[model samples]
Target chain A: MPTRIFGDIPGIPEGSEFESRVMLSHYGVHRPLQAGISGSQLEGADSIVLSGGYEDDEDLGDEIIYTGHGGRSLDTGQQVTDQQLARQNLALALNCQRGLPVRVIRGYNHRSPFSPTEGYRYDGLYRIDSYWRERGRSGFYVWRFRLVKLVTVGAPNQVDEERQTYGETRRVDVTIQRIVRNTEIALHVKELYEYQCQVCRTLVFTSAGPYAEAAHIQPLGRPHNGPDTLTNLLCLCPNHHVMFDFGGFGIANDMGLIGLDGQLHQKANHRIDRQFLAYHREHFLMNP
Target chain B: MPTRIFGDIPGIPEGSEFESRVMLSHYGVHRPLQAGISGSQLEGADSIVLSGGYEDDEDLGDEIIYTGHGGRSLDTGQQVTDQQLARQNLALALNCQRGLPVRVIRGYNHRSPFSPTEGYRYDGLYRIDSYWRERGRSGFYVWRFRLVKLVTVGAPNQVDEERQTYGETRRVDVTIQRIVRNTEIALHVKELYEYQCQVCRTLVFTSAGPYAEAAHIQPLGRPHNGPDTLTNLLCLCPNHHVMFDFGGFGIANDMGLIGLDGQLHQKANHRIDRQFLAYHREHFLMNP
Candidate 1:
């Protein structure tokens, strides 16, 4: 399991920028990809991103006065009610009272020179100077916390741009290659069937074209590793794909779909391998 | 929809080999990857692959006396009853009566000098020389069809090995790359929560490691194009991933997982983006 990160994340110095919050989450420097703050009341707040989300936020590079969560209307960003001293709001206050350090990140939206031009920038550690309840923005009581940067002895370190992009690109791009192959194979199968379900022999007619899914009789991932071959594949409508995958049915050796009364309508070139059908019957089929 | 090839595939010549049935299916040479014959009773048999599947089948380089489908025990590949003139058997008969040329592919399983060492080899087109109902060695009557090679007035053509591999590799390998990314991200999310369900807050313990699925709020491919970012991802057990994907529920902007009471039990850095939650609520959430 990944350990919870607190205060400064080692190796990642101040002013390190990430293209997306998911990248931030992957690195473990800032855990919450969406939330403004990354800490709790019990442990005291350890990290906060000043994304200029709250109207009351003030960013001055070295010093930041950030607004706490809540009180905003869901539809409109305006504060609908007075802020409460609970959840992330109280968590930030705990940091101020305990004199604990908090990691700070600034988003491009955060209207400050230190903020990233596009994504989110991780500014170094900061000490919460003070906290106070103020009534100004949107005519509602808002909790504000002042934070001062805990300056390091050396100059600000900029992470290598090439290294960060390379790592993130490899991780994210490599994921879609398999999806591409699956799509091609599936599309081919669907075209062969004219987007018709094999078992029911019904076409999912649409404006663009027809739609269908390629289901693996023995499955494709771990514990199964079913071959991505035509013999192991079945083109079906979405309903059947879901049902088959959920173990609602299985395919018999003679192309009969278990749980369904009739056999799958045949396509001359799209024959199912007996081995895969047997595999599904043994490992995946559920009682009708 | 792909038009069924009746006689010869344009580019793929005689003697071209395919490593697997899937590849053969991808190319229009033979449609039934598992079935011996690629035709219907109405359309006549267009192709036949000599895979040495029948005990009484005889293969002479220029001619093949092939056994018809059916009347064999599924558990044991033995003739258990009299083979009838139906399905592919009738289809081959139509080819003989019509004098229609049928494509012939030889598999490594076929005991003949002309068969491929491995995979399936397209030998060339053949004419049905004669067909007869004969009593087999097992004392069961079987429909046997004799095929004579319809020789092309040219040297046999072999498909370029490199070209075939390159095409097939690109098509199949590209599929799992996205799967790899999804796995990595899902694994990271599971580790973040120590393999616990965020919605139900229960740990799924296993011997090797805890299993959890990472679900996307807006989905990743096609019409939605949801980002594979952390904000759009949720770590849930299998039940939830299936239910959520099947549109069982959605997450509100405030992190409340709809259809279930209360908010999602969140980890410090594992916050879901409000945009994705809202997207799910609008698009995927089904009435509960």
Candidate 2:
């Protein structure tokens, strides 16, 4: 049941602290141990913690505000009634109507120097930017929200879930041009493989960096065009650049590891150009 | 240093069991705790257990003999000297001169009913087949070896290790004839995706069976020769069949998940042929 993760969790970072809330539910940042919201009115909200627990929250180090859970009164912290929007408050109003972001964290309390003087911190992705209902200081009503801070990384409006298959599902889109190489030659072969994976040398990391990819070795476009040079790149690790462009494995003029199981770590000043590994074993191996 | 595995470790099986040897080193199975051998002499002996710590070992369910560690005597099991051929006994004589295999396990003692009435069990993959050096009954000069028990899976003498890649490395081998298809229509679309992965339902397993991989949505050879029909297969799982034959992602006509990040999950009576997803978005999505 942990699958809710909206913005950044991979390799966590932002102010990062944690010591409890069961270590922010073991690094999912804020996974409700006593419920300061975590998610679900059906999959909407994906995190939250803030911990000034509502006398109208308002953290302000990168804007927060928060509140929304239930009537209050954990033994006279007062309020006692009117607070329902329903489950994780309609899951943070469906991450403010689906622009999604969430995460946040903060916690500790001594009255907000942006909180955390003892435990939870995380402070990273936000964007709920609006929500309301009001009336507080114990006269009831409650709800609130607000949010903000999500510095940079804006494009791709978040959506990534692959792993699909089902034959004959009519999918169709076909516009073609191809040869799109030199993004600084795939970031110079992914910083010459420090981003790893020349076939399983692995190196994932992610809150957006250290990932690895490059790949191409022959065929840059239509009918085996094969070349956008740097001897046709290779870095790999997006599952070995889609298993070396979909023909699962092959590479052996002494840099061994022919294919399938894994472990070919080589590094010596890279050198791949054996005619693009003989055009990937003549157009991708079919059992030999 | 563990990473010596040879025939089968993925999803362990053969009699399985383990309660300690530190729970068989947290399931890389027999990874030495009180050391009854577990690889290295530059990667050789990958695992062994055998309960009777060598009184001229024997066991014999499908054949055994074993022994070879050091010359005995923790007190009076005697022969405390002359036993070297070097660590893990030249790693079980380099798995009896490289026919590789190894793993074994057993360890329970009452002197064998095929052992294991208690702690370890595993009993699978053996093959050392012969070693020698002899002289003991507690007299000294030991070593023995022999083994056996592998059972079937004959061919593929086991090499498998792709992930080696060095630029300019002279790799070559091009014999292309292609068109192989029909292994029962990719095992009937991998048992209609019960072998899961239609995008990422994932199914892994691997004691040798449940792994997925049918792929093909188009290109079956050369200039996209396409066809071998079933509206061009898909099953996937080897990293989504190399990111849908390396375009990485593209299946929208209502199935969404276009080019990367991933989470597609669809299922129904498979039907896929939209001109093979429009020939994989015009020969592998070059963005847009």
- The Cα error of candidate 2 at residue B161, in Å, is 26
Model 2 lDDT on a 0 to 1 scale: 0.60
TM-score of each: 0.28, 0.26
Instruction: Supply every candidate's count of residue pairs whose N, Cα or C atoms clash at under 3 angstroms.
Output: 16, 34
Best by the lDDT measure: 1
TM-score of 1: 0.28
Query: TM-score: which candidate is best?
Result: 1
Please give the range of 10 consecutive residues that has the lowest summed lDDT in model 2 chain A: A170-179
**Tens-digit lDDT string for candidate 1 (B1-288):** 465455567788777889987888789788876898888875577788788788888776665778889898999988899877778887887566445668888888888777878998888776675454556888887777767664333212211111112112222123223333454575577778876788877544321123456777776643346787787888876545644654456677777767767788788888778887776665444332
What's the lDDT for all of these models? 0.64, 0.60
In candidate 2, stretches whose alpha carbon ends up further than 4 angstroms from where it belongs are: A1-105, A109-189, A193-234, A238-268, A271-288, B1-106, B110-190, B193-234, B238-288
TM-score of 2: 0.26
